[model samples]
Target: MTDQAIIKTGGKQYRVAVGDKLRIEKLTADVGANVDFAEVLFVGAGADARIGTPLVEGAKVNAVVRSHGRGKKLIVYKFRRRKNYRRKNGHRQPYTEVEITGISA
Candidate 1:
């Protein structure tokens, strides 16, 4: 059996294990920097699982910043049929990639 855990960050929850890479919301850290997430939602080892109320005290998940990049561009278009008005725009959301290093509970 493998050990797995769920952590919350940036208004999102991610189920991850060691050495797993994930792309999430923009974080204020440089590449190769270590970040700790204290809000653990759940953890599983073998057949036993533990859950937290909002967060578990003394529980943390550490990760290393891998890279920062912008996501795919999304086109926004607004048009009115009778008014003959049209607007077009594009947007790209910034994001950060991180690799899970260890989880302690």
Candidate 2:
């Protein structure tokens, strides 16, 4: 029953609370699917927080997938000043939008 918790996903960690909306790396769940994050690193509010050695045992985060989409395109360019070499590329990373529904610890 903490106000916030830190959960890990997609090789990254995020501090989140109930009702928070965030975009995370692409997930396999379909839109509107429920997802649970079990790799909780920390939980609780303020001084009451509990931090895990690597991951907290018996801690989890519940969320609902809002959507799946690609992020804004990013342009990558490479050039050689005197070699007349030029290269350009664009990339869009896929992501999942989710809303924090609840946390259990």
Give per-model TM-scores. 0.91, 0.94
Candidate 1 minimal-lDDT segment of 10 residues: 43-52
What TM-score number comes out for model 1?
0.91
TM-score of 2: 0.94
Pairs clashing in candidate 2? none
- Per-residue accuracy of model 2 over 53-85 as CA lDDT, tens digit each: 988889999999999999999999999999999
Model 2: lDDT of residue 51: 90
For residue 13, what is the lDDT in candidate 1?
A: 95
Q: Best by TM-score, which number? A: 2
